[model samples]
Target: MPNRLRRAVAGLIAAVLLTASATTATTANAAPSSGFDNWSCKPSAAHPNPLVLLHGLGGNGPGNYSFLGPFLAAKGYCAFTLAYGQATPAIPVGGTVSIAQSSAEIQAFVQQVRQATGAAKVDIVGHSEGGFQSIYGPKVRGYAGQVGKVVALAPPTHGTEFGGLVSVGDYLGLRPLVDQVLQQFGCPACDELIVGGAAVAKLTTGPIAQPGVAYTVIASRFDALVTPHETSFIREPGVTNKYVQDTCPLDPVGHVGLAFDPTVAQLVANALDPAHASRVVCAFGPPL
Candidate 1:
């Protein structure tokens, strides 16, 4: 099967799993439920702009925020998430969308948030393809001036092997199929996107970060998706890098695991609140 089709199938699986697992955390005893705690949380003077959460491919906006949005909300940041890159609102799985379009969507979404909240800027957290989506507004649409910070999780800041498969598909004249498949997920450059990952290459083809905003990356040692691991990091002038394995040598957290991991969530929260940076202690296991 073509990688595109394989992804469609995977997206279906992810949608089902997400619906089941994502909603379970909202109950009263949900153990802080990571970011889910902050959905309706009021913004304090310390954190003004609402935090936006972007999900990976095959993810709906609510699925992305099940924990993350609420978590930020509870911590005093108004949290919002939207379904981007979806061809049909009914399905809401992202894969077939265009990077440029998603970036534009993010820019517009940010404007909407700022207008609604009358805030200065926002902090963005993105996972997987969303990592790319989160930065699109800042990089492509020139919203870096308006964005406070960006944190990317398992992002393909550089292209990956998954893109090579798309190259093979394009060379064989499957470009149309690739584009159509990508369109379903609201990704326009599927051929170019997974064709060894050209989005980040293009994003960093010039300067990686704008002058005012901060860039932080969280990467796992055993990421099976963005292979070679280094692709997860964006090397530029104003970026901070953290590797989970570097701190927790015994941590076997992989790509997907990091998305759902509490430790990773705490690191993300700490990143959001840098004053508490002292709380981050790399652990060999859960013992820390």
Candidate 2:
């Protein structure tokens, strides 16, 4: 190879090595410096409401919000996470149970958080399926007053097109096949997320937002899962809707990437405690 080509290859290899090292380090130490899952940590005046994190679509607590947990804790808030909707009674994969079942689990968990922290209410942050659950739980379960704010990232508020599969499925009456495939993957939430599905239809038939809780949705235009992109928006009054590209044009974070995106994490921190909102950084890599 020419001298110039050799130099370019060497530079690229070095960059890749640096990125790999950074990713490893981040994964190893994603937990907060202050520590998490501590039942003893009480809410302070600066962070009065405890933050509950709900993971989305076949995700668990630690796997999904490892970075965000520590990030929020570093910001002076008590953060907690719950695992719900396991696919099979024997298996441990979450986000596979019905949305209602998961929502019920969330209600119980939030109640536990309130009792443990001795706080009147709690703030919630969720991604993908968790996004809608965070709101749906409070609204349907009559716990609206117990939640102060909800921040959803890349949530499918309305059912998704699945790249028009939903439309096609409806036209062809293929609900059973779709449900069967979702079941094979242990994704009960899939049935609910499909366009014109029962759970999705029920959520839309009523109000999407609760009476007192504040709602913020952070989504990406490039999200192929939630097609038309507009479906991610919460249409209820007083909802704060934001598209990542609008705030950071260069950001290409997609649906699942939102949880791992550090910029999106910062946005969650800001939403949780708006009085002391952090600066939104526009860097892209592993969310951590």
Candidate 3:
């Protein structure tokens, strides 16, 4: 199946899982469950900077981050997630808009989080396309000095092959058709993920990481979405690039699983606060 269809299928799965696993308390305040979207919460000394969660393509804030929000809050960190790239609110999928537009949304959200928490800066934790926003928003576009650290989970920093389908499409001269079909899903970001797409060409041509902002990319060798896997790796001098398999050899987590994996969550915690990093345990389970 094409990547577009696969994404639609993923959206269905997210909807089902969201409904099945929801608690009454969280469901009652579904807009911002698990300490997310809470304007009243202030940043604590132990966690001076608030953490923002960016979801992947075809994923909304609550659906993508229901697990990570509470996880970070338990660590005394103020976490927040917002819905962006929504060309159709009736459809409800997020991160479907162009990267440039999404970057603007991130900028606005970062400011809002900063004003609400009374913090000078915010740390970003993004998954998939969200990872791109975490970097582009702070480094290239908005949020300039307001961003401190960024942790990208299974990000296609360079680009992907649609799980090797891009090569097939290119060989058959179906690249444009494929891109068009994916874009029809109400997500222009999908077109940007194409191998030689304009977005990929532009992002890779410049310095991906900016000065004064710490960067970490946690990728999976087994990730099926980010083809070649190396696309997710950052070769910059100062960036800390981690392979999930290296941290836990038994981990079979794929692209989507990176967000749901508990081990990856622990890794995120470690990245957020390296000074007081927790000892990560090796375990096996579905991202749920």
Candidate 4:
């Protein structure tokens, strides 16, 4: 890679680390985000399925769903979040392990939520890597029947190129070197996310979606990470794919901001319960 491109990649990595650190600090000091990890909350008639919120790479459950958790809870849904793919018991970050391992963790959590709530099926709302697992768990990890619906936000359903950086690396035959660097940094999941990688191939070998499960994918046009943005869409018959700009042209929320954007939250609410669907209210400026 050229010196300039190398510097850019290094800078991006630094930003991710800083963001993770700040998120961890915020989570440690503040009270638990509302509507998460409430074991006593039961599924209601209006919303019979408990919601499972899955975070992205280097994200903890509480920090990722701080906005959406409370948003859904206010709508009378029993919501839950869990941190999976932690490299060690001491690591606060998640989604760093292999994709298959993370899928198993999701499967176990789903089973636990079902048993506790006595609900036959649970809905899933996954952001980024979490979004990938939402489909991977059901299709690849034998979690089909246990899930009712999946609402994926900026999910790299087909995989991403990190704005063509991975593609450039491939052209230069530096893919292996890149993988080694990511592995050294404790993010095997990063390798799996590269376009046409082994993990992505396994996930996309057959149909990406399972039968009897409703699927909705929401992407942001301004997402700088999941480049081309269209990769987030699942080209299946029953799956609904949407861009944030489709409903709100002025909204500029990106990959990380998808979790905090209110419009995205409303879109999630609509997907989880189409029977009570309402118009998505648009907002401006930073995600809140």
- Per-model lDDT: 0.63, 0.70, 0.72, 0.76
Tens-digit per-residue lDDT, 21-87, candidate 3 = 4532453343322245566667777788899999877666776676666667667777888878776
Per-residue lDDT of model 1, residues 125-206, tens digit only: 9877777666656877777878888888877777666643222123223456545655544345444445355675677677
TM-score of each: 0.75, 0.79, 0.82, 0.81
What TM-score should be assigned to candidate 4? 0.81
Q: For residue 12, what is the lDDT in candidate 1?
A: 44
Model 2: weakest 10-residue lDDT segment is: 164-173
Question: Which of candidates 1 and 2 reaches a greater TM-score?
Answer: 2
Provide backbone clash counts, one per model.
29, 2, 0, 0
Clashes of 1: 29
Q: What is the C-alpha RMSD of each candidate to the true structure, in Å?
A: 7.2, 8.1, 6.4, 7.1
What's the lDDT for candidate 1? Answer: 0.63
**Weakest lDDT window of 10 consecutive positions for candidate 4:** 163-172
Cα-lDDT of candidate 3: 0.72
Off by over 4 Å in 4: 1-34, 163-185, 285-288
Which is the winner by lDDT between candidate 1 and candidate 4?
4
